[model samples]
Target: MQDKTNNQESSLTRRDFIKTAAIGAGAAAIVSMSLTEGQSQTQPAEAPKTQPSATPLKLEDVLKKAREKLYPRCRVCPECDGRACSGEVPGMGGIGSGKSFHNNYDSLAKIQLKMKTFHDVKKPDTSITLWGHKLAVPILSAATGGVTYNMGLKGKMTDEEYIDALLGGCIKAGTIGMAADGIGDPLDIYEIRLKAVAKYNGKAIATIKPKTQEEIIKRIRMIEKAGGLAFAVDIDSAGRAARALPGQTVEPKTMKQLKELAQCTKLPFIIKGIMTVEEAEMAVECGAAGIVVSNHGGRVLDHTPGSADVLAPIADKVKGKIVIFVDGGIRYGADVLKMLALGADAVLVGRPLLRGAVGGGQDGVALLINKMKNELVDSMVLTGTADVKKVKRDILIV
Candidate 1:
């Protein structure tokens, strides 16, 4: 809830935050040069360090578009940082109490990096392979839908157009995209998304609600026919029973059902919306290919800890065996680095990208991803991290 105050402290922009960090890094480099001035002649000469005012990233321009397109409708606040939009899940805010929303941001902020001045820091390798295809960054778009109902962007664009823009952006950026389905959505509307995913040649993923086995399987068959690379079911959607469609219901999967569902697909089976180590273990037992440490962007449950708060423990319980990804309060590239250090193969971003699609369409999404990639590299260089895959616990000041 301190986003306004914190964003003010961010000096009005994300660039300013990176600028300050860069300046501190420059200062550290200068001190290191001073101490090693007369070291062994075999050492390669290094450039002198002086603080350079970092320039604003080109991505900032997209926010200008977002401001015009969003705002009044979504606000597109100075910072996409969670506070302004908590407790409004059905319309872009977190679920009741907003505590879960605040926790994701708070826990990530509490994790400070142990930056080093002397070491072999290479260009950060931000690439990762998800479900067999390589991506430029270890990031994915969180499955989100209902621009009219959820984003309040009525009259701005239709649902089909919105899905196209988001998915197109991700694929163009050399990464995968996620297309979401809602229980209230008509079957035809859901199939429209399936066609879009197929157009991307199976690079896009499909997400289903936790509906009855027959309905869920029917949808899965459709997704596979569409050439989706993988599929997931947001179990958190089960809590929205009041919103269930007539003749349709959503419920949590029993272990038996989960195993059967996993068997239903040759593509990777991902179980999203998991928050407990026990549930995470259950996912493994059910033959899941991945598990997303999410609290449904804090939109499904109230009074729960943020995904970041529980991720470390869940990750400790199941790390290499399952592709672990996390998604709440992930507004920055530094947050991506933090999650990877804590134990995540990748991270997903939600609201900001929605704004990106709303404002600049595919271009905006690519710009946002490129910006996060740059910021991740910057943070890695400052911390002397050479590789993302081998990120160590020592990097955390803890």
Candidate 2:
């Protein structure tokens, strides 16, 4: 019986050993398959590389490129010939004597002063309600003539395109646009600008340099019919001319003439080219809803003090009666801030738009306006003003 039991145990041990060996072989086969699959599925890691096409160009870079490509350096140095040293020469080549040309530096200085003086201590309210329309900022595109003549791609765009660019770009950027009349027959330019303003749903102040009060009324009526929200008489340009251009021949409308024209239109009346407090007061008394305290952008009288310089006094005198606006050498948001601080309800941009138009048409104008708006916003943020109306005199150091 012992021999039989030993034989059975030996058989069981042999069977168990065979079963273990078979399972080990199967497991080895499975491990080999998994290793092969893993090797097949694995990918080698690579170092990251930058693609040239994926990099973004900054706005300054884009503008620099565009400016280089489109605009040539201005050859005419009007500033150098007209700048007068204070206390050095009487009637010398300087602003304020009518013998010199417009100087942006002078304009900027005054603008800075007004901005610092008025805006320094006072809370600036940049938001303006004019003619029942709310504007984000008071900086409007003042009515400018000869933009097409001065700057265009060889007249690539029509008058309508010019107006469209100004209205759609500048007006939409938070400023109203004024269209200058008397560049040609009043009706044609007026109609073109009116249509452009309607297209953009923007506000426009149409200006007429009429030969007579009757003509002023007729032009004002036409402007209103064409959807102009305000009317301005370019009183400064009535009998003035720049260097060689044919002088404009509008009769000097009396205060009564201005009032009669204002009465003819239901829209707000804006008198452009006011440089004195007395003139500002007269404008208000004449029922002017607004007064543009400008020196015809220093075009009419070359040697006049920069528009910025006179803004504070005029603004102080006419604060409650009318919306005080200014134009001249406004190149940046800082310039706008300076004007606002000085007591201007708003400011106007002139040559910069022409520069943009000359450089890139509508896109160029839009770029210029966008840059200005961004600059304004940056200034506001840096000064800790959240709202446009909050920009005050204290924000400026000088």
Candidate 3:
């Protein structure tokens, strides 16, 4: 039998069932809805509002608004795992097959939390200090941009507006955000994001693509002038060199080039795409102050392991040698605890935070972070974990 809600449309697609599966069996009532071009861009469609409870219902409102704002480009699905929009690169899904993206979600989900209630662990400390800035939570916004083509929000939202929402929201939440470097962006577009970073002087991170050494150094100088607390080079973007527009080039960096980039800046230099123990070791050898275990959210690769799948081994090899951070499929505070127990100094959240920004602006972003902060505190209390900075490995049944 056909579903009545999808009046004029056919039965639900694989993506729709995937969404239901991720949320729960009951989420079938909230099947994905397709919007016309006119409605997709202009009107805000009503989505299912989450049931009110002790947990804040604000995120559902934010997701509903974001779904309207980012329709077609992103369904803002019940689950943000790559399943619903797998293999969509220009838009929001991962690269070919999206196996890498799926890995991120599966790897984290496979680890079971060992809950303990027989302890006096009240008021867990969810704070951590990164480069002298004390954060209310161990979360930061990963560098993300390309709002126009990537998010289909060109006319609806400008690049500056998006960056402001991200950086400003992170600051409001007592954490930090990273401004991205779009492969096809013009010099002016890049400068505008830097200005946003400068707006939060010494509180934000600026990320550059894996362009040439000269080009990388040039942007580092600009980041320094912007008073950025740190700068990162997403070496994983090297895979998209062919997609780069003329005059904007990307390439893999050699150890010599990496060292030069690290020494050229007074700010902390982070290498943002280390996925292996060998590469993690090389990042330390290159004098990087930090390394983000990522696969560009599985956007740049097809069959790579999830950051969660590889984080512990990499962390075991270089956890204290350099600050270790992980990103990819981190959607909740429980996931944050799992990553910490597996060995991560902190976690970087991408898509959900992006939804918060696109859907609810700065306040939306702050609300999302604050919600996760509360969840993190609760998770810590139940697991006998006392602090974000000192999470133990025994808290998980991996």
Candidate 4:
């Protein structure tokens, strides 16, 4: 009786149901008019069927739609200048004044590739062997994360899901993937990510934040256990004084401390966040297997020169001494080629790969990588460069 009473209180009448259906589905009622008025009522002509386009939507087009629907913090803009997202340090923006972020883009833009012709070159080989792993291209996805803080939860992807797409996608595309360590993230997160990475035959690399020596060493041990090919530490993260987790500390390392850490690890130890020539020299001196010319993606400090502007000097000084990799403002394959000409053995792509992984998963990442590779090849052919390994300095319009 009580259930009957509740049903009766909210019951819908037949008229109400019809009205609701009409309102909900936009049902058009064809009421029969008075038959006497127009006995010979003519039927309406049939509408023509629209044909679907023969060409399918490209992966980039699909990614554009996914960007709108899934990604929250990042809009995946056509151009990723710092203007749309400024002073967004804890997230994706730069620190303090946002000048550092702007500098990365501006400095890279200042470099112009001198076009050339009249050389017998077909397709340039764009492969490089790093840390005993041969990559299809001289490009790899930079270590990027913080889906909750950096990209946002609305991306409809978990940290694990994102990393799976990122690392897995890169590996599938014939390259390496770099996994990131978040300050706020728990330790187990790294374990889960590395477990996923193991399927790629340890081609995926990992980067640790500048945690304390004990913490850094502990994490390095974990990476070693995970069958990782190499590991890196972003020392520039020390500038992020405002965002460190409680009980976590990031400090500058002395030469002795760096050598100690270097000696402890058997893996190819890479030191990221080298901005100036001095730091680049110091990194090699400390027994680094490789050094990344980066400004922490301009997230650590404000008003620093972009990695591109300083890359040539660093490369000239330590080109053969230590393997040189660079990141920042690398939007396309042309940019990748530019970095190679300026003096980078390889380049790390950050946000674009994130968007690719979020939008189309493995396929999306592979497509983006292919796009960059295609563009790099096109740039190489036009410049009459036969081999990617021997990209001449003269090709650059310094």
TM-score of each model, paired residue for residue: 0.84, 0.69, 0.87, 0.83
> CA RMSD for every model?
10.6, 26.6, 7.9, 16.0
Among all windows of 10 consecutive residues in model 2, the one with the lowest summed lDDT is 31-40
lDDT on C-alpha atoms for all candidate structures = 0.77, 0.59, 0.83, 0.76
In candidate 2, which residue ranges exceed 4 Å CA deviation? 1-104, 110-126, 152-154, 183-186, 241-248, 384-387, 394-398
Give the per-residue lDDT of model 3 (tens digit) for 289-397.
Answer: 9999999899998999988989999989998888888999998889999999989998899998999898777767777777777778889999999988889999999
1-398: candidate 1 lDDT, tens digit per residue: 69887767766454445344334433332111111112212111221222332332234455555555554445566565556666776777777777787787787888899878698786767778786787878878988888777776678778888888788877655677899987788898899899889988878889998999999999999998999999998988889676776766999889999999999879888899999999999999999999999988878888888787888889999998899989988878888898998899989898888877776677567667766777888889988877778777678876
Task: State the lDDT of candidate 2 residue by residue for 1-398, as single tens digits.
Answer: 99997686577654354344334433432211001111211111110122323222233333333233222221112222233222211112223543323454456644332222223422333466776877756567767554343332344556676677666555535556777674344466667777776665536777877456766777776776777788788887664433224433466667888888778767888888888888898888888888887766555655667777678888778886788778877878777877776788778787566545443444445555656765765566556555554456666555
lDDT of 4 by residue, 1-398 (tens): 99996686469764344334334323332222111111111100111122333343255554564455333355555577675567886666777787888888888777788788788787678888887777888889999878777876544678788888888777656788899987767888777788767766677888988888899999888888888999999888876546666876777788988898899989988999999999899988999999999987888878898888999999999998899999987988888988998899999998778877876675467667767887888899888887777888888776
Worst 10 residues of 1 by lDDT: 29-38
* Model 4 spans > 4 angstroms off: 1-57, 69-72, 241-243
Report how far off residue 13 is in candidate 4 (Å).
Answer: 51
Better of 1 and 2 by TM-score: 1
